[model samples]
Target: MKFLIAFLAVVAVALAGPIDERGAQIVKYTNDHQGISGYNVEVETSNGIRTIEQAELRNLGNDNAAIVVRGSYSYTGDDGQVYTVNYIADENGFQPEAAHLPRA
Candidate 1:
């Protein structure tokens, strides 16, 4: 039991990874009111991170009404490569697409 516990402890520490000491600052940001129905947002960070999203009300004032969201985000990975993901969430479900993702 002790050996198992110590093994698990070691695995946890290895998986946790080292904390980054650097700080990221927001370099750009924008929020726009697209009327009473929805809004749009965009942001960029000094540390090579960016995201944009838009939301709109669907089926307004109905029992099945929902807010549909569409968005994309990009960030620099540890390997120094930029990764971007585009996504949408609506009546069906959340779908994300990116070059790195495997084909279904």
Candidate 2:
């Protein structure tokens, strides 16, 4: 998720428009984190971009546990369509569901 944020920052800078103008700003934000326990985050921007995520630690017993995370993010495209992706990451690995993703 951190990598995704970084990549988006780079892309935003590259397409930030005029040099003298500021880019999109945050319109709303919320975060609740408790270290390994888990976290929940939500954010919205001046542009039509929004992200929401929630995660929790689940114990599998016998001193084993894992963090289960699920989230979805959406952004307005140049063509005026809103693109969104829903994903999950846990013991099974990353799984993303979106119309643009190719099927196996």
**Candidate 2 residue-wise lDDT, 44-75, digit = tens:** 98877899999999994546698899999998
TM-score of model 2 relative to the true fold? 0.72
lDDT of 1 by residue, 1-104 (tens): 99999999999998777536377789999999888698899999887889999999999988999889999999888776899999999998999999999979
**True lDDT of residue 69, candidate 2:** 96
User: How many pairs of residues collide in model 2?
Assistant: 0
lDDT of 2: 0.88
Clashing pairs in 2: none
102 in model 2: Cα distance from truth in Å? Answer: 1.3
Highest TM-score: give the candidate number. 1
Poorest 10 consecutive residues of model 1 by lDDT?
A: 15-24
- Residue 53 in model 1: shift from native, Å? 0.1
